[model samples]
Target chain A: MEVTINNIRKEFERFPALNDVSLKIASGELIALLGPSGSGKTTLLRLIAGLDFPTGGQIFFGDEDASHHSVQERNVGFVFQHYALFRHMTVAENIGFGLKVRPSSSRPPKSEIRRRVSDLLDMVQLGGLEKRYPNQLSGGQRQRVALARAMAIEPRILLLDEPFGALDAKVRKELRRWLREFHDRTGHTTVFVTHDQEEALELADRVVVMSQGKIEQVGSADDVYDRPGSPFVFSFIGESSHLPVEVKEKTVFFQGQPIGISEAAAGGGELFFRPEDISLVEAQDALFGKVTACRRLAGTRIAEIDIANDGHAPYHVEVEVPLHAPVALGSEVRFRPTRWKVFENA
Target chain B: MSDKARTSNPAFRDPADEGFATKVALLLLSLAFLIFFLFLPLLSVFVEAFREGWGAYYEALAEPDAAAAIRLTLLVAAIAVPLNLVFGLCASWAIAKFEFKGKAFLITLIDLPFSISPVISGLVYVLLFGSGSLLGPLLKSWGIEILFAVPGIVLATVFVTFPFVARELIPLMQDQGSGDEEAALSLGASGWQTFRFVTLPNIKWGLLYGVLLCNARAMGEFGAVSVVSGRIRGLTNTMPLHVEILYNEYNMVAAFAVASLLALLALVTLALKTLLELRFGAGNAGGRH
Candidate 1:
C-alpha cells in the first residue's frame, strides 16, 4: 500500500530527531533510507511502523489516516537489526505467531496457519528446519527466519532496520542479494534503514539520503550517486577527496596556477571527486604535485599526492592505479581531475 | 632442547600470567570457609533432627500442636506468596517499563522492608490492627480479630516479603526492553495476549525465583510472626512461635524438634536458590532484546 509521512517531527528532550520531514512511498516500492549514524533514518522508519508517535505530524496508509493507530493496527512487518527472534520459540512457532494471534473474526484455520508457515519458511529457504530454535541457526539463517516471520501475516508494508547489519561481511553481501530477490518475488512495499552506502546503492530501487534529521536527497541509485543534490550527499554516498580551488574570473586556479575548468568557473569552491575519477596522466590539464606515500591494496596500489599551491594548504589527493603500476614515494607527477563538482564550504 | 626446558622460556610464557600455586591456595581457602560457615551448620541441623533415629522423627510428627503449627505455616505461605507475586509483578512492571514523576521514590518504597527490620514491619501492622489503633474499633465492630489471627500473620509476612519478587524481576524486565512486546503488538496481538504470550514467558523464570524466595521466607519467618502472633497454643501460634512456647515451658526436646524442621526449610531454600541459578542463570534468560 502507498504510505505518506507528512511534516513528521520528533523531539527527544531538547534535540530534534525528525525535523518536519515529509516523504511519499509508492505502493510495492522497495526504498532504502541511507545515512550515516545519527542521521535519523531509523527514527523515520519507527514512526511509519507506529512503534513511535511523532511529536507533531500525520501519517497515512493509502487514504486512511494512521497517525493515531497503534502498532498492531498499523499491520506493518518490522525486522530488527538483531533479528529479535523469540529465543524460547521454534522457527515454525515463531512464523505462525502472527497468524495464531489474529482475532477470531480474522483468524485462519489451524491447517491454513501450518500451510502458510511452511510456505513462508520455504520462501526464506529454511523449509526443512522449521523445528530448529534461533540459537541453533547461523546468523544469516536467523535473519531469514526473522524475515519469514515478518512476512507471515502478509503485511502491507515491510520494514527492515538493518536486517543484515549484524552478520559478517561475506554473509551480509549474500543476504543483501537474497533480500532484494525476496522483495522482488513478494512485491511488498519495503523500507529498510541502513548507513551502509554500498548496500543502499546495490539493493534499493530508490535511495533516500538523510543528514541531520532531514532528507538531503531522494533518487534512484544512479541519480544520487552520479548527480548528488548537495555536498552532504556527495560526501556521504561514496569515497571522495576534496581539492581547494580559487575561481578568478572565468578560470579556476589550483594552487595559484591556472587550471582548465570543465565549464566556466562558478567562483571559489571546494572540488569534490572520487579517487577513481582522477587518472594519473603524463601531461594535459596537469596539476603538478609530489607523491607523499604509496601503498598496495587488495587489487590496486594507492598513492597519496600533496599538490602544493602557494598561500594555501597542500591539497591531499588519492590516486588508485593497477597493482602492477610502477610508482615510488617522493616521485614527481602531473595529476588531472577527470570528473569533479564544486560546493560552497559550509 | 627438552620439551620442559623449551616451554620454560620467558618469551614463551603466557602474557596473561596467573600464578597457579596462588590460585590453588586461594580456592582451597574459599572451600574451607564455605565448609566451616555454611555446610557445617546445615550438617549439625540434620544430625540433631535424627538424633534418636526414626523414633524421635515419628514422635515429633505425631504431636497435634506440631501438625497444627506446620499447617498454619503452610497456609500463611499459600496466602502470602501469591499475593506478593501479583504485587511484585505490578510494581516491577511499573518501575521497569514506565517512567513517571517520583519513580525513584516508589522504588525506594518497595525496598523499604528490605532495609528496615522485619520486626518493625510486623509492629507497624500490629499498631494498625491492635485495640489502640483507629482501625481496631472498626475491625472489632465487624468481628475481625486481625492482631493475633491468621490474617494478621499472613499480612505481616506479606509486608516483610513484598520486595523479594519485585526486586528479582525489575532488573530482568528493565534489561529486556519493550522491543519484543512491541513486535508482538505489531503482529496483531492484543495487550493482554502480548503480555500473556511474550512478556510472561520471558519473565516466568524470574517470577518463579521470586515466588520461591517469598515462600521460603514466609514459611520460616520468626521475628515478624513472633511479634504479631500472640502464641496461643493450637490457635494463633505458628511453627516459630510454637518453638518458643515449647522451649519456655521446659519442653526442650519438642522445641529442638520444631527448630530442626524450620532449619530443614532453610536448607531447602538454599537448594532452591542454587537450582534457580542453574536453571535460569544470567546467561540463560532475560536481556534478549
Candidate 2:
C-alpha cells in the first residue's frame, strides 16, 4: 500500500520531535528514514506504524486517514530495534500470536494458523526451529523470527526500527542483503529507520534524510549523494571538505585571491567538495594549504590540509591522494576543487 | 620474599584477593550472625513446640480455638491475596508502561504500607472505620458491622500487604519495557490481547514472586489484624493473634505450636522463593532479556 504522511508534527511536552514532516511512499517501495540518534527518524517510523500519534498530521494507508487509528486498526507490521520477540514463547507460538488474538468471529482456524506460521518460518528460513524459544536462538535468528512474526499478520506495510541494529557487523551485512531480497520477494511497502548511511543507501529505493526533526533531503541514493540539497546532507551523507570562501559574480575566492573557478553564485559562503574531487595543480595562485597530518586508509592516503583564512581561524579539510603521492607533514600542496558547490551563509 | 612465600605455601594470592585473616574473619562473622539471629530462633520455635511431645503438639493444634485461628488465617489470605494481586498487576502496569501525572505520588501511596509501621497502618483503618469515626456510625446505622468485623480485618490486611506485589513487579516490568506490548499492538492485537499474551507472560515470574510474598504477609499479619479483629475467640482470631492470645493466657504449648505453624509457613515460603530464584534467577525473577 502507498503510505502518505501529510504535515506530521510531533512534540514531547512542547519540545518538537518532528516538525512539519511530509512524505509520500509509493506502493511496494522500500524507503529508509535515515538520521543520527535523536534525529526523529525512529519517531517518524513509529508514527507511520501507529505506535505513536502525531500532534498535527494525517497519515493515509492507501486512501484511508489513519492518523488517530490504533496500531491494531492500522494493521502495520512493526519490528523493534531489540527484536521484541516474546521471550517466553516458542518461535511458532510467537508467529501465531497475532492470528490467535483476533476476535473469534474473524479468527483463522487452528490448523490454518499453524500452516501460516510454518510457512512464515520457512520464508524467514527457520522452518524447523519452531519450538525453540527466543533465548535459544542467535541474534540474527531471533531477528528473523521477529520479522516472521510481524509478517504473519500479512500487514498493510512493514515498518522496521533498526531491525538489524543489535547484530554484529558481519550479521548486519548478511541481514541487510537478506532483508533486501526478502523485501523484493514479499514486496510489501516497507519503511525502515536506520542511522547507518551505508545500510540506507544500499537497501533503500528512496532515502529520506532527517536531522533535528526536519527532513534535510529525500531522493534516491545517488541523487542525495551526488546532489545534496543542503549543507547538512552534503556533510552527512559522505566524506566532504568545506572552506570559507567569498563569491564575486560567478568567481569563487579564498582569502581575497581568485582560484580560477568562475561558476559560483555571488555571495560570501562556504564551498564544499568531496575529498577526491580535487587534483594537484602547479599554478602559483591555485587554492592551496599546508599538510599537517597524513593517514593511510585502504590503498590511499588522506592528507589533512589546514588553509589560513584572512583574520579568522584556519579551516581544516581532507584531501585524498594516491598512496605513493609526495605528501608529507608541513608540505604546502597547491590544488583546486575540480567540483564544488557554495552554500551562502545563512 | 613474596616469591618464596608463594613457593612455600603454593597459595599466593592475587592482588584482587583479600588477606586470608580478613576473609576468614568476615566469613565467620556472617556465619555467626546468621546462626544467632536466624537459625537459633527458627530452631527454638520448633523445639519449644515439641517440648511436651508430638502428642501434645497435635492436641494443641487440634484445639478448637487454634483450628478456628488457622481457618480464619487461611480465609483472610484467600480474600486478601487475590485482591492485592489484581491491584498490584494494574498498579505496576500503569506505573511502568505509561507516563502520567501523579505517578510518583501513586507509587509513594502504594509504598505507604511498607514505610509506615504495620501498627500505624492498622490504626489508620481504625480511625477511618472505628465506631467513634464518621463512617463507622453510618455503617452501623445501615445494619453493617465494619470496625470490629471481618470486613475491617480484611481491610487492614489488604492495606498492610498492598505494596508487596506491585513493589516486586514495578522495577521488573520497567526493565522489561513496553516494547513487546507495542509489537503485539502493531500486529493487530487489541490492548487486552496485548496485555494477556505479551505483557502478562513477560512479567509472570515477577508476578508470582510478588503474590507469594503478599500471601505470606497476609497470613502472618498480627498488628494490623489485631487492631480490627477485636480478638474475638473462635471468630475474629487469626493465627498470629491466636498465638499471642495463647501466650498471654499462659497456654505455652499451644502458643508455640501455633507459632511453629506460622514458622512452617514462613519456611515453605522461603523454600518456594529459593526454588523460584533457582528456576528463574535472582533479583527481577525470570531471566533478564
Best by TM-score: 2
lDDT of 2 by residue, B1-289 (tens): 8778877985666768888799999999999999999999999999999999999999999999899999999998999999999999999989998899999999999998988888888888889978789998998999998877788889999999999999999998899888888888887888888888888877777788899999999999988888889999999999999999999999888999999999999999999988876655732333343
State which candidate has the highest lDDT: 2
Residue A143 deviation, candidate 1, in Å?
1.0
> Which tens-of-lDDT digit does each residue in A111-178 have in candidate 2?
99999999999999998998887888999999999999999998999999998789999999999999
The worst-scoring run of ten residues by lDDT in candidate 2 chain B lies at B280-289
Cα TM-score of candidate 1: 0.90
Q: TM-score of each candidate?
A: 0.90, 0.96
Q: Per-residue CA lDDT of candidate 1, range A1-346, in tens? A: 9999999999888699999899999999999999988999999999999988999999999999999999888899999888878777788988899999998888999999999999998899988998887878999998999889899888989999987789999999999999999899899999999999999999999999999999999999999999988989988887677777777776667767666665354677887877677667776556767889888767777878887766677878887755786577888877667788887656
For model 1, state the Cα shift of residue A79 in Å. 1.1
Model 1 chain A is weakest, by summed lDDT over 10 consecutive residues, at A257-266
Give each model's whole-structure lDDT.
Answer: 0.86, 0.90
